[model samples]
Target: MYYDIIVLGVVVSILFSELTRLSPAGLVVPGYFVLSLHSPMRAAYTLLIAFLALGAEKLLGRVMILYGRRSFAALILLSFLIDGAIQASGIWAGNPGMIGCLVAGILARELERQGIVRSLGALGVVTGVLSLLLLAMGHPVFGTQGVWR
Candidate 1:
């Protein structure tokens, strides 16, 4: 079931991106997010970290050149550092782990390319649609109290 959802997510993301000329965060980001619908806080925390990383990148952009592979690598590294700091500080109970950080980094990079509002809007739409489908399928989307379950 999880595998099917992931496959559908990838397909939907690709179709949406091609049709709209916008990325829903990243190709696989929506899938990752749908998995975390049970714990929305986890998604929120990940977004917070991604925003922090974006701010750092903007600040760093002024001091040095950031583009292409360099910018991508820096974002990933910054995400990891931020995730670690958040975990060490116990700022948020949920740790999104490396994959979460990577997704956040990817999303942040897209946010930089496309604008925050648009990027986030697309993400929200895709996530919401996928979440609804998962819910309709009676999956454990927001917990075990789902209608079908």
Candidate 2:
């Protein structure tokens, strides 16, 4: 199931991005997110962590010049730091590992480019479509016995 979801998610994300010319939160992000579907709160927590990284980048951007690779590195570093901080705070114990290795950073990048509303809207739409496709594939995570099995 995990294998299927990740591969399919990448494929879906690429297709969506090509069609819309948007990142869809990066190619692998939707896959990571879809895996969290069984636990909605975990998904929300992941989003919170991503938003935190994005916010941190905004703050950091004000102090120094952050663009291109610098901006990307800062976002990834921040995501890891914030994820660690959250875990250390004992809030959730496990931090869901950043949705994907670069999910938060890439997502932050997109949000900055397109604004939160448009970026998230694109992400939500892509993920929702991916979820529906997974459902049709008979993935147990979606409570389906396997319509296409």
Across 1-149, the per-residue lDDT of candidate 1 in tens digits comes to 76777787888888888989888888788888887776667778778878889899989999999998888778878888888888899866656454454888888888888889888888888878888877677676777552223
Show model 2 residue runs off by greater than 4 Å: 91-97, 143-149
Candidate 1, poorest ten consecutive residues by summed lDDT? 140-149
RMSD of each: 2.9, 3.3
- For 1-149, candidate 2 gives per-residue lDDT tens digits of 66777888899989988898887877788887777776666668778877899899989999999998998899889988998888888887655555656777778878887789888988899889988887677665542332222
For candidate 1, list the clashing residue pairs, or say none.
none
- All candidates: TM-score: 0.86, 0.85
Tell me, by TM-score, which candidate is best: 1
lDDT of each: 0.79, 0.79
Model 2, residue 71: what's the lDDT?
88
TM-score of 1: 0.86
